[model samples]
Target: MTDTPGWASPGTAPSNEEREPGASGPTEPADRPGHTPPAPQPGAQPPGPGVKWSKEQPPPGQWSAPTGAPSPQQTPPPPPPGPGWTGQPPGGYGGGYGGPPAGYGGYGAPGGPGAWGGGWGGPPPAAKPGVIPLRPLGVGEILDGAVSTMRTHWRTVLGISLTVALLTEISLVLLQGFVLNDALAQVRVGNRAANPDEVFRALPDMMIGAGIIAVVTTIAVVIATALLTTITSRAVLGRTVSLGEAWRDARPQLPRLFGLILLLGLIVFGVMAGGALPGILVMAVGGDVVAGAGLLVLGLLAASVVTTWLVIRFCLSTPALMLERQSVVKALSRSAKLVRGSWWRTFGIMLLTGLIVRIVQVLIAIPFAVIGAAVSGDGITDLLGTGGGHTGWAYLIIQGIGALIGSALTLPISAGVTVLLYIDQRIRREALDLELARAAGVQASGAGAPGPVPGS
Candidate 1:
């Protein structure tokens, strides 16, 4: 009260008896819980540049230091304008980030990045640099990442895919042109009945040609995976990488990767052959046709189930081998570990991604297939090499072009989804998001690295 304050006037303010006891005094502000007002000093001049301001103690649980130190309970104000600071004020308009005020823990530092992916703290922040956001991904995000990577790194992604596809198409064309047409033409020319004996007689030649195709395709798969793996690695960090750079980083792992693919293929072949052996034996003995057919169906079904399980379990091996640079056995073990608890989810993603890839392949291939068929005026069987009519050289050339284009477009999507699945699972199980953030030059609250993911 102006009227009651110890006869209040300019210099002579009211005493506590005449005014509220905790009210601000004329010369100083009120005291806060861990702070004390500094006693008046001679010629202090309000503590200017280069001089330490007098005691303004932080409350308990707060770390105290000079400039650049963080405050305990709030966003620390930015330090004095230094070189390259652009002369903005601290923590305000144009003073903070030119982009979003992302706390290293993700924007606004809200509760530690939502447990690396378990607890839904809303959607994760979109940290750019990579096509995908650097968080555990949703189904949409996974697909988006794949598409975005293709768009952003079209030169590399398309280049690698198309190159591999071209080579693969060439091999296929040669096989169809030179071997398949000739082999089947022989059967047709002889006018032989399509019995088991006849088919078996030609089987050895078929196997030889098939073996050559397998080797070529396997090499193509390895090349594509290696290039895509390196690209994805850089993509995760939101960095752009070149074709040369990807090759440099991935080349060393190719031999081992090829070996791993062959080894796995053999293991799978062995399992399938072993499982289906009883049915094979029944058919070989020429028993009752219905009984043999039923046994064959059962054996095939059982083998299919086993193959699916094994495929899902080791699906991550390619990424593990390339990215982790591990040996074949270690990569298999690593993939198994990543796939252990999340089998169903991984299976679903795999199945869906594969279905999508196949659909795209069909869509792309259909027109070419139609053109090839139309040009030849041959039946469906001739288009696909049945009845030994032999697809003409012209059909081979036309179909090869279509297959090349389809392979070019589809390879990136298929490879990307697989690699992203591996990354997603690691983020879910091993807190890989934090490592990714650091690698991408993002971070968490000045903390060295993010810890384990919750529920991991």
Candidate 2:
């Protein structure tokens, strides 16, 4: 067999038989006469490459051509090139047929990290400045996160809130029954001849009851806040921690949490006491008229300013304490630090959230109040003691129930905002956005690798 210049040997089937070796020899071209038979134009198989044809077939009209090749066909005239074309003639196109079109790498075109890095191929967009790069959180988003947490760990949020609510109601009821009832009954019966003596005698019981309620309620609140905070943090981070797990994480911080509550109560009490002190002194000096008028103006102003400052400073301390696992003092310091430059903004957000929550609480309370009044066999007027029909204790009880309902509904929203505020501060201070994104199960580049070894 004749060998083709580039064809494989005939031992195995050639990639292209048209380029295979001929039967005669390796030296001569396959087209040489007497080496290989000419392929049939109609139905005959063409001889493989390297096989010499008996006679080379001439082109249809190519005798004048040097190698008897076919002459180019002349057909319909071509259209003139458009604006972007460049070639030998307007009709002859070249150069633009292959590769990416012009302006491919420009800003608007599809290339690396196109606007927000959201196009076909590239790394993700850089985070925006000032804004926390967390998943977008609206009221609905926050509510959804809370609901998801509840759904996953219903026993935790519900169990804790319900338990606290029940205990609170029972304690309040018991206070109304045993403690307040005895004191009020004595007052009603005029047992002590002198009002001052009765007041002094009853003060200890009142103070003891108040202290018990405060401590118990504060403990409940601290537990609730910690559980809710940890659960919410896990939820916000898209992690699935159980209520038991959250509670366990929170239990260790109970003392600190209670300290935070105590600190808040003290701040509130101090402000209120300071505001009231001037009135007390004025009364002691000038009696009722001047004292009342002076206290009305000065007390309110002082209270407002102090209350605003306290709220701004301590608004997020509980969540900060819980999440950061800090002592009460540390949590207060952390809160002060976070709120340092943004006190007004933080206050405004808190005020807005409070106003909205208060409105919701009012709405929820109204229906419950109405229901409680109806259940107590008192119309609205009777319930208010304005119809000359005093439902008395019944009215107070109904009102308390209404307050309870309102508190229940407001609790979650208030707790949610507090938790969110802590997260917002972290995101601002630390690069917590990246850590949160990672926690939310977003697979970041090089994220799986261990962090740098110490001292390395």
Candidate 3:
């Protein structure tokens, strides 16, 4: 095989066989017939005159070197010129015969570490400027980003979560301690009555109280989610935002965000109601009872499926609304667009997150609840014997405290996951990581930034 400039083959002596036509080196080996080796240098010193010549001499060309020249063991001259070669280094001018092409040392080019766009190894590691790397995220990565956001920006994240949790828990405690207590007392008294009307009449008061509590809690969650979404977005840019700053950024979109959430709830409720309507009407008209019951069951099942699908489809509406400053309708559309082909993946991630949140909430709340029940009532005996029928001030307060703490800790995780999931979806579909990289001011090639977004 022929040796090329700067890329000589291992263990092979340099040969003059393929040298350029007018090159100075001899084309044939000295052993070849009629091949004459170069004569001794004219200036070379002869052997000492007094020295006697040995009768036995080796072959003339064997193991020979010119008098003043370097042997193969010493530093070698530059490789001989070949076709299109200037005898320069292997990867310079005309590179080695099979070397990488020009511009191969670039970021994602063939010859560099990112050869074949990472086909030789793996794709270049994505840029990570903050809580998450700028690329499509795995489920674990999404969860970690949420936890990391809370860790990196604890002040803002905890502030929002704690404030919302406190307000919601306090309202619940007061309602349960005062109004709900009276309502429950009346219900218990009416339970002694044989009259069904009396028992039914006492139920609305408790239901109304529970409904008010739910509304308060929902509002609190909405506010927290809005603020936390903004904070997560900034965290992705490697920027810290104060609670007040997050509030200001989120304030303008609050009304629309509330509307978006309300609309989604209504959509699910409407679908469920519509599904049950046909069966309700059938029973109301005194049709075949068995058939009516079956239809009701089927309708309800269908409604459940539809509701779940819609929920996942619009799960990203919150982030879209807050970050894009979009109207309620537009945000829903955006979520639908992002979630179009990723329904199952989105559902799985959301379902897993929900399970994690629920588990954490239960784990944190259970101990406090046990303590509250034991302290408020006549201890564990009263709770276990009466099936937890008693509700007292101590129980409510203790339980509320547990709820407050649990909410404070879990709120950021849930909110962060949602926002990061939205961003991940966008990165997959819209190449959003490039924009994020630019917005974060990271120095990477081909990175871009969206135009100034409102509330940013």
lDDT of each: 0.69, 0.57, 0.71
Candidate 3 residue lDDT tens string, 198-278: 433444466568657766865676677789998899888888899889988998997897787688768876887788777
C-alpha displacement of 175 in model 2, angstroms? 5.4
Per-residue lDDT of model 2, residues 1-456, tens digit only = 423322222332212233324333222254544768445698766444443443453333222322122235423324434322222332222212221344333222244343221233433433322122363334444444454556665666676676666667666756665556555443433234537545545544554566566656555555566668877777665555665787789889887776777787787667756776666566556566454546745785788698779768876778878877778888888888888887876776667667976797678767766776776655665444344333445655766676666655555555666677677666556656678766666643432222321211
- What does candidate 1's lDDT look like per residue over 49-155, in tens digits? 22232344323323222222333544444453432233334334231433234323222332443312122343334455577666667777787788888888999
Off-target runs (Cα >4 Å) in candidate 2 are 1-109, 112-153, 171-223, 377-379, 385-405, 444-456
Checking candidate 2 for backbone clashes, the offending pairs are: 2-22, 2-25, 3-26, 18-49, 30-51, 30-52, 36-52
Q: Which candidate number would show the highest lDDT if scored against the true structure?
A: 3
User: What is the Cα-based lDDT of residue 307 in candidate 3?
Assistant: 89
| RMSD each, Å | 14.2, 16.7, 11.8
**Cα displacement (Å) at residue 139, model 2:** 6.7
The better candidate by TM-score, 1 or 2, is 1
After aligning candidate 2 to the native by TM-score, how far in Å is the CA of 98 from where it should be?
9.6
Tell me the deviation in Å of residue 81 in model 2.
34
